[model samples]
Target: MTRIASYCIAASALFLLAPSAALAQEGEATPPPAPEGQAAAAAAPAAAPAQAAPAKAEPKEDLKDKPAPNSIYAEGLGAGLWYSINYERRVIDDLGVRVGFSYISIGATVSAGNSSSSASASLLTFPITASYLGVRSGKHALEVGGGVSVTYATAQASNSFGSSASGSGVGAYGSAMVGYRLHPVDGAGFNFRVGAMALIGPGFNVFGDDPTAFGVLPFGYISLGASF
Candidate 1:
């Protein structure tokens, strides 16, 4: 009976030891599953940095191939009972050519003690000019040019001294002008300018030159005009 008890104790001990040995082997052999929270945290930090990289690279495309504003102009001028037709074409941003035709006339009459005199003068002038124009901003501009003018003038006088005089002349002149331009509206608008010009050169008489010889003369012009 004692031997039978000893054998039974040994079998119980073997069974207990077997379970401990198996548990130790399993602990050393198998790996644990990764922690879900830790893995997700690591992945989120990496993804954030990757997403932020694209935003820094996006602005380079926006700065490429940008365009500029349009800079071009066309203008004209006219004035008074003495009228002028002028055209300006811009060759560059601030330089241009001015071309124009002008017409002028004047008449006078006097009487003293039944003696009467009448006088009249008419002129047609054409100017071809090149100009340098400057506009620092919108609505204001300055212009200067030197030009050649061809003028055809006719004068007639009838006096009480029993003399009637008529004269016609053709003149070649050079002139310079400076002016300001004001624009009040948008592109489809008007511009007004005021300026003074000096004309000086020689003339030839076609008829009636005995009393007044045609030669170099100084003439001046004052003008106000608008452009549309």
Candidate 2:
């Protein structure tokens, strides 16, 4: 009976010690508590990512008022020291007006029945004409014009017949001309033209009689010009 009582006491002591051992193991397994501030920081939602400012668009350049397409032409011709200048203007496409001016002087000898006469003359003429542009295309054209002219002439003659004479006269003339023109593509390029002209005057000839000034006055010319 004494041995049995000692065994029961030992069993009771083991039961109390076993409970203390289990509680210590549980405490060791548990994590440490965080600070209040740290806990709040961890639980709060993350701040929204900062938005980027919109980029300012740069201002564009202002370009306006370009040049227009157009041209200016000048024409010129000459024979020896005598020369002419002409210009044409179009009031309507394919039809236009032409005007020109020239100066000339010549000396000649006339022989008739042993009477030899030395004659000299100087003349200035201005022609105003209206033209039709019959054919015009890319770089070439055909043109015709008819008009009147104004002339002023001075002449002096001395002959073996013992006669000397000097005279000055102003005359009106009827005239016609035709032309071929070449237009250049470049703004400052050379333009070319060729043409024939004839004239008739009602008064005494500026050169001589019989043949008359108009009889041998038909002439051809070549010109060079420029376009703007």
lDDT of each candidate versus the true structure: 0.59, 0.66
Q: Model 1: how far is 117 from its true place, Å?
A: 2.9
Q: Write the per-residue lDDT of candidate 1 for residues 3-120, one digit (tens) a residue.
A: 9999999999999899899999998899776799987887775644445345454445321221111222322232211455666565654566666777778999999997999999
Q: Best-fitting candidate, measured by TM-score?
A: 2
Number of clashes in model 2? 0
**Candidate 1 whole-model C-alpha lDDT, 0 to 1:** 0.59
Give model 2's TM-score versus the native structure. Answer: 0.48
Q: Clash number for every model? A: 0, 0
Query: Could you tell me every candidate's TM-score relative to the true structure?
Result: 0.45, 0.48
